[model samples]
Target chain A: DAGVTQSPTHLIKTRGQQVTLRCSPKSGHDTVSWYQQALGQGPQFIFQYYEEEERQRGNFPDRFSGHQFPNYSSELNVNALLLGDSALYLCASSLNGGVYGYTFGSGTRLTVV
Target chain B: GQQVMQIPQYQHVQEGEDFTTYCNSSTTLSNIQWYKQRPGGHPVFLIQLVKSGEVKKQKRLTFQFGEAKKNSSLHITATQTTDVGTYFCAGPYLSSNTGKLIFGQGTTLQVKP
Candidate 1:
């Protein structure tokens, strides 16, 4: 199993609602990044956090925002979610933003109805 | 804009057969990373290549980075049931190498024993 830990292995939500997903980095890790994986597609980078700050972001809108805590844990918040938002959310952790390769969590499956 | 692309979206191979997936990047990459995801599991880090014309091996799997640093490949010497999964290649954006990866579409491998 991946050393990283994530919460709410699965979730069902309605369109227009908001959702929050949490993640805890693996032991001794400090960088956390999030990805959204759609069915039959590759994972898409959302953003990355380092030292409790957002280091970089992807093409996603501001509605898909995230925060990293001092302990290297992170939260992904999506507002006004749409049906297209339904996908598997994956969390990966590493030292220096995956320069050493990333360790991923089981992921949270979000379904928007 | 940075992008990564993978070919042979799906491959079905018999046990003991060989398998290969190719990845290409829109821009030169400092390094390339490989990952594998099971049918219903999150992606797991497989390996990373840094130097040009570099190759690394792990048992039955072999990874190679191109001299141009814009292409890479993962080759399996002998496919096994346990090797069934989707393999992905990711690279940091050339504009911002702060650890945010631009992932490829990935290639799914189905190994029948």
Candidate 2:
């Protein structure tokens, strides 16, 4: 069975623009979470979605929002992105309520130029 | 705010040597998970420890959870070149409204042959 998958392995965006990254969770997984990882740093939690609703959120601003579809696929949207937004956007999927181990996608690298 | 920190920002070891990384949390955690990220790759789930003073092993890797539930460690015996990557420890911090997983700065390991 295929594991978690993310689209557009790499993306480049300009300041003030917007970008959307997609992720398809592992089969049978119900919860999806997003994280941002800067170079040489650990992944920072962005938010988590469960049952097609945002169950939890991190310290990210409203500029960073996300949606999880009924199929358990998720999309992370960034509005008026800034250079600081340049990082690796990672998608992680977990079973139940995210209290278990997570399967992560290769992540989408976003470069703001 | 809950936070996690890792020691020895980076380590370089020759193949067949041993290595260890420590993770500490500012607050108690219900569970802790570990992941490994290779250069230019996504983070992969390694293991999870829940009970305090718990210990588990996967082949050459040993995982431990502190008695206080606020610290963890990952130890690798006889490292190999294939083990080069950054190891991250993460745990969830529960709040009234939302719960988020916080990741440590990570321990980057370089295994040279």
Candidate 3:
């Protein structure tokens, strides 16, 4: 299996601009989760998608939103980005309703200038 | 919201030395998972512990879940260049159905030959 796949390995955006990151879940997986990792820090949970609906959210503001498609692929959309928003965005996928380990993508590096 | 805290944000050790990172959660967890991220790489799943007071090993790495399920740990028997990375412990939120993970801040290990 290809495991999780993310698009746009790196992105550079201006403050106040918006960015969208994409992720394709691993084969046979049905759940997708997004996380943000600042330099020298562990990933912070952003949200999780299952059955094309957001089932859980973190402490992040509503400016961070996401969507999961029918094929279990996912997208993370950040609106009105700030310099502090710059970080590595990670995507992880796991099987729903089962005890399964998560598969993570290489992640997209977002730099807000 | 739950919180996972890790200690000693960074560690520098000589090759062949042992190292350990600890993780504690604000609330009891049903399961705990560990991940390792090489510099400039995404987090990769290391192992998972589902039962309280359970321990598992992988080569030189040992993982343990607390008796109360409120904490966990990762121990490396011998340091190596390959073991130089950030280690993270994560657990699912108490009320999450989508299996969203709350990750600790992580402990970065630097191995010197």
Candidate 4:
């Protein structure tokens, strides 16, 4: 089965601009979550979506937002991007809140200049 | 906020040597999970430990959950070049059903052949 799929394997954006990254959850999964990973750092939780509604969020700023479609696809939007925003954005999917485990995508590398 | 901390931020060893990374959580975790991210790759699920003092093995890698449910460890026996990557330990923040995870800073391993 196809696992979680993310769009734009790599991207470059200017500071103060905006960016949108997309993700398609793995087949048979219903929940989607987003994470940010900097160089030499672990993935940090951003937010989670279930039933098209954001269920929980981490300590990210309001400039970071996300959406989950009815089909279980997700999009992460970052506004007013800064150089620090440059990192790998990962999308993970799970079945029934991921009590078992999570399936992660290849992730999108965002580079802000 | 809950936090997961890992020790020995980096490790380099010969292919025939062994390596282990430790993780500790500030709060009790319902379960702990292990993930491995190859260089320039997204994190992949390794395994999960739930019960207290639980242990699981996968090939040459072994995972352990302490009796207090707040610590974990990953050990590799006779590491190989393929084992070069960052290993992370994560725990669900509050409830497993929330789909929120707190991940450690990760332990990067380099295996020299």
DockQ of each model vs. true complex: 0.80, 0.63, 0.64, 0.82
C-alpha displacement of A41 in model 2, angstroms?
0.9
Task: Give the residue spans of candidate 3 off by over 4 A.
Answer: B95-98
Angstrom error of the Cα, residue B73, model 3: value is 1.4
lDDT for position B112 in model 3: 98
True contacts kept of 3: 0.67
Sort candidate 2 into its docking category. Answer: medium
Q: How high is the CA lDDT of each candidate model?
A: 0.92, 0.90, 0.89, 0.94
Rank list by TM-score: 1, 4, 2, 3
Q: Locate the minimum summed-lDDT window of 10 residues in model 1 chain A.
A: A95-104
Point out the worst 10-residue segment of candidate 1 chain B by lDDT. B93-102
TM value for model 1: 0.97
Pairs in clash, predicted candidate 4? none
Model 3 agreement with the true structure over B12-96: per-residue lDDT tens digits: 9999999999999999988888999889888888898998899999999999999999989899998889999999988887824
Per-residue lDDT tens digits of candidate 1, residues B1-113? 77899999999999999999999999999999999999999899999899999999999999999999999999999898999999999998872445788889999999888
Model 4, span B1-113: residue lDDT tens: 78899999999999989999999999999999999998988889999899999999999999999999999999999999999999999999873645789999999999999
Cα error, residue A9 of model 3, in Å, equals 0.7
Flag clash pairs in model 2.
none
Question: What TM-scores do the predictions have?
Answer: 0.97, 0.96, 0.94, 0.97
